[model samples]
Target: MIRIVLADDQAVVRDGLSMLLGAADDLDVVATASDGSAAVDAVVRWTPDVALVDLRMPGLDGAQVTAEVGRQAPDVRVLILTTYADDDAVLPALRAGAAGYLTKDTTGEALCSAIRTVAAGGSVLDAAVQQRLVALVGPPVPAPEPDIPDGLTTREVDTLRLVAQGLSNQQVATRLVVSEATVKTHVNHLISKLAVDGRPALVAWAWRHGVVH
Candidate 1:
């Protein structure tokens, strides 16, 4: 089972998400916190496999919790579960070593999938959020091939195509018969070459320019 920690200030949201997620057979909501500081405490105490944190909590906030988790509980994967999906918060969260991010508007199934994805050592940034990052960083360059994108290794392109299709890293790894770490390297490389700062950007650029076929 995937062990998880929930950290959002809203009682209704926390309760709803906890109930929804806990119902999944493969998931376990090991602990819940109302804010960032409590999230940190939960990490130190419970050491769950995944932490779903809100970006705007009192005291510590999502980014700070992510950073602390990175330092103090290196084994734990942090996934930002927030309402905002703009660059102002995205960069800091990623820089803090958050493995993935998703909007609070995400469906419960999607949110559960994101937690599992992060726990399995894969990225789970929402596609819309990814586009926002690209807009903030710079304009996306149209791929030369339209159909035949470049800059990434052929394998990297394949990995990105799967990502665009909304497959998790674990799913991609299983499909490709490669390790998840290898898929992650391909993803990072794809992000660098496309100048698409995040998953949403990649999806937008690929759809607009026809990179994935």
Candidate 2:
């Protein structure tokens, strides 16, 4: 069974989530909290497989609780289940190590599925949350035809430009809201496609080809 601690300030929300989650044969609502501090307490006390947290609460808030849970009980995963999906609400919780994010409007089945996913050490983001993250990274700049050298993808071009501008792999990952491993993959592909030896050569090639001016 996937154990869960449901936390939300509203009693109705808490009760509703409890019922919805309890109905799933594979899920168990081990505990429930009506505030953030209580939520964290329940999590630390129960060490459940997943903590389904609300974004805003009286004491700690979802992001703060996520960070605390990560520090105190690293084995437990956090999944944000809140009404808010704005940039300000979503980014901090994600950065604080939330394994999943879903709005309250999510169907009961979807929420249960997300909980299972998080418990299994995977990540999930609601469609609205995903869109917000994409918007934060901004759209890929369209390079004019013929100006797109080496047939690189738009994302690769973006990576190349950032790399040419002296961004490290980690920094590029932060700017693009992706993983460092992903950034490294892009860099490797760029080197192979452009016949560059390494980063310095890539930078030189980018400058020479007017990819980053």
Query: Candidate 2, residues 66-171: lDDT per residue as tens digits?
Result: 9999999899999998786774867778778887789988998888888887797655777677556545544434555325565798889989888766565667
Supply every candidate's count of residue pairs whose N, Cα or C atoms clash at under 3 angstroms. 4, 0
**Model 1 alpha-carbon drift over 4 Å, by segment:** 142-152, 164-166, 173-213
RMSD of 2: 10.2
The lowest-lDDT stretch of 10 consecutive residues in candidate 2 is 137-146
lDDT of 1 at 74: 98
In model 1, what is the error at residue 10, expressed in angstroms? Answer: 1.3
Taking all chains together, the TM-score of candidate 1 against the true structure is 0.78
lDDT of 2: 0.81
Best by TM-score: 1
lDDT of each: 0.81, 0.81
